[model samples]
Target chain A: MPTLLEIHNLSIEYKTRLGTARAVDNVSITLDENKTLGLAGESGCGKSTLGRSIIRLVPYPGRILEGEILLNLDEDVPYENGVVEKGQINLLQLDGDQMRALRGKKLAYIFQDPMTSLNPMERIGKHFVEIIKAHEPDTPKEDAQVRTKDLLEALDILPERVLDYPHQFSGGMRQRVMIGLGLTLTPQLLIADEPTTSLDVIVEAQILNLISDLKDKFNLTMMLITHNLGVLAETADSIAIMYTGRIMEVAPTEALFESPQHPYTQALLQSVPDVRKPDRKLSWIPGSPPSLTEPIPGCMFRPRCPHAMEICATEPPPLMKSTSGGIVACYLYEGS
Target chain B: MMGKSITISGVFIYLRLVQESFRDRSKLWWIVLGVILGGTIALVASLIILAARSNSGLGIPVVVGTILFGVSMLVVGLFRTLLIRKGTFSPRMGTLFLVGVTCILGVITIPVSIFILPAGWFDLWTVFVMGGVAIGIILLFLYSRYSWLKERGSPGFLTITGFLMVLSIIYMTVISYWIVPYDPAAINVGPILWPPHPGFPLGTTSLGQDLLSRTIAGGGIMLQVAFLSVLICFFVGVPLGLLSSFRGGALDRVLSLIMDAIFAFPGLILAIAIAAMLGPGVINMALAIAVVYIPSYFRVLRSQVLTIKELPYVEAAKALGARDRDTMLRYVLPNSLPSIIVVMSINFADAVLTAAGLTFVGLGLPIDVADWGWDLTFGWHQLITGAWWVITFPGIMIVLLALGFTLVGEGLNEILTPMLKE
Candidate 1:
């Protein structure tokens, strides 16, 4: 499969009253067409920030300082000046109008909280109509309405309930509506930013299943951001572990789980309780993730790493290829 | 030729559409009612015209009979609708009927008193006392059975009280010309500084103007200035506040600085200064009061806008490709309006008081104008002469008007703040 999105050396920082907090440090990621890349991290570990930067929607006080988010697969390259020979278009270089044009049609985003994500004042059908008409101006109202109805039906939501306000629906139903809205334009990339964090476990499974089914049906490349390894294990083809605004490891889901290389990944996996092995005590990593505002000099994970060395305290470990057909950022996997 | 045919066919088509819309069995009653109403109006209008043409003694009875018949039919229709459709008497409908009747009586009596009554048939105080009693009866009925009165609890009671006070002032303003025993501006109508008499009621002022007439007429001018001033303050302050908060940084800082400078002074004193500079007129007084109140509105609305702009729904709007203008108007403004309304209501009382103060200091409208402030200035001298009615009436009018607005503001605050929280 061809690479749908190639994010290279992306950095984002938030200037606050305290100081400038580096939310996303020189991070790099690649997502192939029809593939699901799960981004897993502890809370405030910059997974959400990285997802937002993909769509250039980092909220106030947060700035994307430097990055190259090359969208290689969009059919129409409206601006010809910066198109590479390989047909990759850098999203960061586009102006506001150009970015808006690309947002709903080419790259869609689903926020974490379903309660807050949907506009309370607007009906569900109106949300779909607005998004459709905003991108495709000449699309007839009847066509948009029909499409919205069909999409709602596909998502297992009652099409008749499309006229209902956001407050009328349950949390899980609202999330389904959000998902339906995301798929309205049928974008190439759908970034799900902790989409199921605010739902119950049962509803979370259903939403994840719905997302997986939708992705396959539409042939979409997805970036599923969450802190739950179990959720990633079920839905993601590949998993990327992020720590302190940096990717510590990236591998195929099975490979990363079976032969975890990075200490942070290993500690994270150990913490997940196994029902099959009841005797195995759940092990947790000591100390919290480093604060983004006052980052330590060396590897951000060194203080928390059980296998930290003197060199780990002085220098940040570079990402190196592992024998397990994946990359790990740790000294232990230096020559492997 | 083609244009004439098209126009004829267009009229036919429109008529057909209207017929089709009323074809349903459910809609037949509406058509019947419309026809009945149209016929009644035509009959009454023709009778009035005949009366005017003939100049006969039969005209008065015919006109009165037609009006009474129309009124009876309306009452019957209302009852029928209530009993048939709702199967119960709704308190809201009852309140509406009462208010309608009151308005009709006011309309009838005001014109009749102005045009038909002999100049000295009755003292102006008699009309005022009668109107007050009728209003009191209606208010008592509302207090007991008005649905919102029960639903809104204590705030609702306050709202009704405020509403009634304001209504009385409006009633006085409207009927002032017809009900005043003498024209408020007419000097030497009686002996100067006379005690309360059967005709004068309140007494004669220093200029021998009827104090009762002056006080009633003064309400009209007072309400006009206060309402206009509050309206100006609202228009100037709300938009500026919304714009400043939405487009923060330099614009916001400048607006805040300007507003603070204005706010730093005592409100009445500032109004007095502005009123003095603007010169004496009703418009000038209103403008002065508006300037003093604008800062309060600005401060209230700016804070509300700032908080609302940061809500998740606003960010969601931007994420959905909503333009800056759409986001501000659709999301931010609607959410912030309740606070603005509350502020405006609260500032109304203050604006009235400020305008009166400016006038009392001889900076408001000219002394000849029948205004509460001008009356107070004239009446103050009579106080030492034991002519208490001169100052007391105008003072009471000012206090009552201010109290009415204050209650309304407090009531709205109580009702709106909780709704915002929800």
Candidate 2:
């Protein structure tokens, strides 16, 4: 499959009273066309920050220091001149207007908390209409409302309830409404950042199923950022395990799950209690992810790695091919 | 212990009445009957007092008609009290208390809104009477239909009264010329310092200009200044705040500092200085008052923007490729509206007052113009001479107008505060 997006040596830093902390290090990721890429990590693993940065919406004090977010979509090339190179567009170089034009249209993003993510004062239909009208001012409000109804219907929500305000909807319905909003524009890439974190298990399943169906329907290249390994297993085609702002492993879901190469990925997979294997004891990785405020030499996960060696401490391990048909950043995978 | 229940709020007393009356061995019908009886007696006493107070006695129908409506409210209150005593009422005593209190408030506003109009202005008097009756009926229907109307989230007495007060002033301002018996500026229209005698309602000023005509006409210019100044402040300050907070950095700091500098001065003193500098014209006075109020709107909107922009919805909007303008207008502005509304009503109250103060100090329209501030200031010495009607009527109009805005502002604040949890 052709590469849909690629990040080259991306670095994001957050300014603080103490000092600027590097939240996302020189991380490189390649997302395949029409494929779901899972970015899994613990909380504050810079996954959400990384997801926000793709849309150039890093929260205050946090910024993209250096990165080339190449959007490889072959479409109308929504760029002026300099940002486009040989068909692909470097999103980082686009001006405010160009970058925003791609948002909600080519690259839409959904947040974690559904309750607070929708504006309380605005009705669900109004939210859709505002976004549609913003991009296409010629679209009549009624026309937009018709499209909103169709989208809501697909999400299993009553289309007639479109005029209802955010507070009127329950948590699950609001999330569905938000999803409908994201899908209304038929975005090329939908970055869902912990989209089901706040929802109950049943709603989460329904949302995941809805997303899977929509992904096929829209032919969308999705970036699913979540800490839930099981969620990634069900949804993502390929998984990229992120630890301390660096990708420790990148492999197909089955390859990573069946023959996980990176110790961190193994530790993560072991921690998930298996219902099928009743005798298998659940495990956990000891030691917290290190503070990003201070620089650390060599592997970011070296201190937490059970197989920590002198070589792991000497220098940061480069991502290399592992026997599991995936890339691993652990030194133990060298020449594997 | 009883005093606690009787504390300043009449609502608490109503609640105490219901709870205490429950302890009485009287039947429900008897209790309701007693309230109707009491209301009749009170109505008779007010009629006697009003009938005796009327000098020409021709205003007896208007007075008698207004009091009869007030008595009908006592029946409405008893209906609500009994409704609350039924299971349909929310178990919260606050809602029950609000129902009883609003009934009392409805009755109270009838007298207060009525007394302000002199007996002779039949057209003006009838409009207020009809308007009050219409509102009371509509409200009674609404309150009876929806028990949720008594919820804490609902608008309270102050907001309702404020709406009436403000609307009446605006209505009076609009139809003043059509309704006024004489031209507001027409001198020698009545005897000087006349005390609301027949043919000369609201008495007459020292210049023999009709005080009722002057008071009614006075509203137009004051409202114009208040509305214009508020418009200017809203246009300038809201944008400044929105831009500063949304586009924070040097702009936020610089704009916030300028607003703070303006806010640092005493409101009246700043208006005085500005009005003094600008000199006396309607536009000039509006500009002067606007200078005093822009900082308030700025501070309010700026802080609101600061808070709202941080919310997830704002970030989500940004993610949707929304332009800065869209994010500000669709997301930020709508979310910030509650405080904006509160500030606007409060600002209007202060603006009109400041305009009057500016005019009082010889800074508004020419002295011969029929403005409340000019008439009040010019007629101040007449009050010392025991001719209270001249200053008193005009003074009461200004107070009522200002009070109208204050009530709306505070009432909106109470209603909207809980809705905006973020």
DockQ of 2: 0.34
Candidate 1 lDDT over residue span A132-189, tens digit each: 8777778999999999999999989899987777767889999998888888888889
How far residue B303's Cα lies from its native spot in candidate 1, in Å, is 1.2
Return the clash pairs for model 1, or none.
none
Candidate 2 runs further than 4 Å off: A78-86, A134-143, A277-281, B1-154, B178-182, B194-203, B419-422
Instruction: Return the TM-score for each candidate structure.
Output: 0.79, 0.79
- The per-model lDDT (C-alpha) reads 0.75, 0.76
lDDT of 1 by residue, B50-117 (tens): 32233233334323433343354345445644664675655556656646664565455544544544
Evaluated at residue A322, the lDDT of candidate 1 is 81
lDDT of 2 at A31: 90
True lDDT of residue B160, candidate 2: 55
Model 2, TM vs. native: 0.79
Winning model by lDDT: 2
Q: What is each candidate's fraction of native interface contacts (fnat)?
A: 0.27, 0.68
Cα lDDT of candidate 1 equals 0.75
Classified by CAPRI criteria, candidate 2 counts as: acceptable
